[model samples]
Target: MSSTPTDARLMDGSGLARRLVEETAARAADLTRRTGTPPCLATVLVGEDPASVTYVRMKRARCEKAGIRSRHVELPATTTTAEVVATLEGLSNDPEVHGILLQHPVGPGIDERAAFEAIAPEKDVDGVTFSSFATMSFGLPGFVSCTPGGIMRLLDAYGVDPAGKRAVVVGRSAILGKPAGMMLLARNATVTYCHSHTADLSAAVREADILVAAVGRPRFIKGEDIKPGAVVVDAGYNPGNVGDVDFDTAVTRAGLITPVPGGVGPMTIAVLLAQTVDAAERQLA
Candidate 1:
């Protein structure tokens, strides 16, 4: 027996990121000519988590490509929370620094929330600050968490209007999963959030018109869980660059799906750059 192939449109985040970067670079050049001061993003990371290192490196490399300066601070693994906060505090006060991104998931014993709060709202380009989250929750114009921002952009690019849809987001991280649900809610989607404590993950996923898998466990969501014709956003950045949903089966069930590495990952950095430039524009004003 022959099976009919389903049409699941693949969302190309890498392609969109490239175009955004080109436009951003042009704007960065114009800004250089206007003020003779280039926009800079200060990246602070504690310890050497491989994933964090890769992410920070990617950010700096993208910044250079976009003509945005990057100042990197690699704190020693033994550094105390106070020292980390002090470093970020100093960067927050620097007028020359247009944006600040403290790479997520600091070492054990570090107060991540306290460190995030130390960043000036204007310079919190990564959108990890409480001020930023509050604004995002209320649908105000402020920096959004990069991964969530990217997911919204992806939805827009594909013409998947969230208005009146049943949107389900798995995971509740302050940065990725939580903000994504809030973004969908702001766009008029009825959002449901599920985490480790949820009783039935599959049931929650099936009710979604738009399902976002961001639980960080590779292949946690199976194809059987997806609602047919649902729009799937896989925002998981796990080991081996795999996503939370089982892509092979999900594509058969989904109307659209974002791939792991080239999907939300690229878009995250693109959003960061855009926000950084926006911060610079605000500072310039």
Candidate 2:
């Protein structure tokens, strides 16, 4: 059957992110009004990867627009892992900083996990810390990884009930893939994770009612592997802004699909701002 436009809905992450950011800005203003302090996010970057620099700058710009304060800490390319961790720890201890974001791919030598763990759990608004992961896995009250949290928000906004659904998350990165599966599991979805080591990846993907492609390879998940009418969330942001799922073919098969540039990207920053506000509110209380 030839699929009509109504056969698949384009999940508008940009639109939803705009609404979320607006709400977050209002909350940030209200919090500042009540506490005499604006919610602050401290962004730490190790080494100057051009893409990481641009991403951090964008996040700070969003923070400014949302009425949140941003503190930037830039380290040299020669900085050691311990130095990076120490810098993050200092920011974590700063009372004025309600959120901490350590831009990923801090060069090749740095121990990324150790640095991520340096951020205090309460201020881990980017949700990279072990404590934050545990909390998110348990469905506890804690900040979640921005991308995964944003994905969940998109799901909710579109009225995609995950309860009893079979969800396949393609990738196992701590921040994006693993957390995404955990979030879906929390919502009562039977979740399966597929990574580079997973055998028969296509077989797993074919079983999913909901599929999240976060493997970071452009057009890695083919349309033939997608279950018809599946909810497809493409969270990959590779060079040229291409997504993991082959969008042109997958769109015809999916019941709903998120576009590459207009989809998961915007929601990530929106979730960060919202969580920063939430952290600030909790700290004030």
lDDT of 1 at 212: 89
Q: For every candidate structure, what is the RMSD over all alpha carbons to the true structure, in angstroms?
A: 2.3, 2.1
Off by over 4 Å in 2: 1-6
Please report, as a residue range, the 10-residue window in candidate 1 with the lowest summed lDDT: 1-10
lDDT of 2 by residue, 250-281 (tens): 88789999998989999999999999999999
**Top candidate when judged by lDDT against the true structure:** 2
Could you tell me which 10 consecutive residues in candidate 2 have the lowest summed lDDT?
Answer: 1-10
Q: Give the Cα lDDT of each candidate.
A: 0.91, 0.93
Candidate 1, residue 18: how far the Cα is off, in Å: 0.8
- For model 1, what is the C-alpha lDDT against the true structure? 0.91
RMSD of 2: 2.1
TM, every model? 0.97, 0.97
